[model samples]
Target: MSLFYLLAVILIASAIFTITQKSPVYSVVGLLVNFLALAALYFTLNAEFLGVIQIVIYSGAILMLFVFVIALLSSGVGPFRAGPNRLPRIAAPALLTTLVAFGFLIFGIAQRPFGPLPPHRPTSFLGNVGDPNVFGSVGDFGVALFTVQLLPFEVTAFILMVAVIGVVLIAGDAVPQPTLGRHRPQKRAAEREPILKAPAP
Candidate 1:
């Protein structure tokens, strides 16, 4: 559909924007746009619960956390320094792995007969779009999340927690500077050099 194509374009453009920005703030803004567009795509697919979760959890919570981290890092004494690059060391292996994955994907697709996709509406499991009781409804999603998919749900939550913890640990005290409510004494004016010493006459 035209709507799907439009959303797909937006998704791809925003994704590219997110990665190509020089400023992290701009990148985050682009990422937020990408998330919103993804949620819209989910809505088009009738996955309302997923759309809402994508917006609420990823856009609301995770994005805000990233912004807070960026702000905290910016509050330090100087611009944050980056670690050594290992891209050169891993580039060849990464390219080989990608090619192997693509080969598998192509082989798998070749095995399946191409045919028209089934109609989207009035499915056996999901039911009609207007139905009060449907697979993608909040109640159903909750039930499934808590029952058959409980392990995956818990594992995802655990991974998110670990990611948050890792961010906190890595962002901690990379520079020796005062944090909230903690101040270091400044050097005396006499002990410090002048910003511009008077030129010798």
Candidate 2:
């Protein structure tokens, strides 16, 4: 219980730091810590598969992507602040969203009956949907994803595929020349084309 509380504190603190930090790199690091703390909390709850997935998918893959984007955008080795925030407009929406989410979490926790969890054992996904042993385990998640949510899963995959293709198209060197901004080495006055104007008729 003490370990759980400790992990929970770290998770909340890191999560707060992730949002409040001025530096993008620091924010990413805080988020990584937050993810690890969440994984540890899952381990305490006996959800080993969830913990592994949290570490592998979120901390490993997602955080790596964030770091890569940070590196790509950063001019300096340390603390390159990110994008447009003329009035820090996102801060308002972010704060409101966090408050709503926190309210939901508090309400849910208050409504939930707290008690010690029962002992677990290995069981197949096929039987006993009511008291399934596969619950909280990776196999159950896989079964749910591949079975009940199959259509949504396929749609999500297709959307992701389209997104990747769009990124490739945007990043490739063969961008259309017409839309590009004109640069220096100005054309000589004689060489420049004159616009034809109709005399008032």
Best by TM-score: 1
Screening candidate 1 with a backbone cut-off below 3 angstroms (N, C-alpha, C), the clashing residue pairs are: none
By summed lDDT, the worst window of 10 consecutive residues in model 2 runs over 122-131
CA deviation > 4 Å runs, candidate 1 = 77-81, 85-96, 122-133, 154-201
Error of 1 at 147 (Å): 3.5
- RMSD, every candidate, angstroms: 8.6, 9.3
Query: TM-scores of the models, in the given order?
Result: 0.64, 0.61
Please write out the lDDT profile of model 1 over residues 40-96, one tens digit for every residue.
988877778989999999999999999988987878735567679887899899889
Residue 79 displacement (Å), model 1: 11
Single out the weakest 10-residue window by summed lDDT for candidate 1.
122-131
lDDT of each: 0.82, 0.80
Candidate 2 deviant stretches above 4 angstroms: 76-84, 100-131, 170-201
